[model samples]
Target: MDLKLVILFLFPVVIGSLGNLSLLCHSVFLYCSGHRSRSIDVIVRHLTVANTLFLLSRGIPQIMAAFGKQDFLNNVGCKLVFYLQVTAKGVSVSTTCMLSVFQAITISPRSCGWAELKLKAAKHIGRSVIMFWVLHMLLNIRVPIIVSDKRNNTNIMNIIDFQYCSVMISSKEKTTTFVALTLSHDILCLKLMIWSSSSMIFILYRHKKRTQHIHHSSISSRASPETRASQSILILVCTFVSFYALSSLMYVWFSLYIKAAWWLVKTSALTNAGFPTVSPFILMTREQFVCESTRKK
Candidate 1:
């Protein structure tokens, strides 16, 4: 076993699990305590869930395999684990997009039509979250079908051989169709996230310009809670996009080049898991999250 690789994976698993768990508990505590959570908070709660699952689904198996445990996942385990990991990632992508879009709407000018849309959007957040889960789960229902236990990790014919959980992806037609659909979903998510982020940036810029005549201290006080929240979400979105792009490139490289080296495969897995490991800290920095956490203690 490579001690470095083991530590590398283990560190993120421990840190990410704790961070996500803290946020998850915090979100639940707010709702349970009858503290009204906004649409963005609700979305952040769900994003936390998906991130936790992504970490667990990938982390445990990788850790087991790193300890020289091979073929630990049976056929059923492989199918379930593989499907859940990918679906968790899909839900994460869609949820982040939703968060950004709503933040944009939240910060939009009151004169714009977004006023009504914002009200309705909050009302339908539950439906939207359900829709994201259903969409990703339905879209990847066949993921388990293509996944099975692999007898060997060095198979050039396999698309993904994770030592324990291997995916055959043997059907060319199915592979192409799945790839096309996934790309379509990701593209739409990316476009919406970028649009919303850009809109938020523009709005912030305009607000700053309008407040330029004010004293520096006044300007510091001028940053509203919404502005600060928007900025945090913007940072979260940027982190997600960076990891998402890296993971996508690695995915494409693996798809095109089947005989990828073992180090590259591990790198791809780490890249794919990056956002889940990093995002909760970005979110926990929210003024409300921190304040509430302090109050609870």
Candidate 2:
């Protein structure tokens, strides 16, 4: 294994693991401290776990392969790793969408339709999270069936791809149908996130203008906590969209060209790992507990 490849895989794994773990610990601490966990907090706790699982499932296998342990994963190992990675990724996407939508509803005017959803959503957060896990697990069940350990054949030209597992589809129709379903699910989640984030931004802008008009020269020096939290969530959404786009593009390209160059495949993996690595820190910055903990320290 090349030293550079090891660093590429290991760096994100360590950073992502630490970030997610910190967020998880902080969330747990807040919940255990008799604080009423808000809907967003519950969603965030789940997101942190999903992100950690995503990093572990996706990064560990790559790191093992990079360290000259290609055979470390057998058929079952490949299936388990790939399946877990895909499911975790779906959960991450779903939780992020939920976060955006929850915040949008929280900040909406009382007369708005979203306000109506806020109460019911709060009550069903646990059930929604369970459904997310179940839906993704069922959606990606074909992953384990399709993925297997790559066979080593001395006769064929060996083009090293970053993926350790080879995907086998019994029929083109089944592959097409699976791809379509997966794409539809991802696009729907992305649309929901984009819509919620855009609405939040518009609402914030209108509120700011109204505040300026009412307060005239005496506008406050600092933004309210709600405004700050909304801005942070918006930034998080934008970051996720950017990383998700890059990852999706790479996935499509790699799918079309299975023999993609090693560096290209490595780049794809990095993009896939980007959001989980950075999002936790973004979230932590907006967390009140993190601020309180820091001051105490």
Q: Can you write out model 1's per-residue Cα lDDT over 149-182, one digit (the tens) per residue?
A: 8653345475666777776656678888999999
Question: How close to the true structure is residue 173 of candidate 1, measured as C-alpha lDDT?
Answer: 86
- Candidate 2 whole-model C-alpha lDDT, 0 to 1: 0.83
Model 1 alpha-carbon miss at residue 45, Å = 1.3
What candidate 1 gets wrong by more than 4 Å, as runs, is 152-156, 219-222, 287-297
lDDT of each: 0.84, 0.83
lDDT digits (tens) for residues 142-244 of candidate 2? 9887677776422334233445765553466887898898899889999999899989999999888778756545455546667777888899999999999
Cα TM-score per model: 0.92, 0.90
**Cα-based RMSD of the predictions, in order?**
3.0, 3.4
Scanning candidate 2 in windows of ten residues, the lowest lDDT window is 152-161
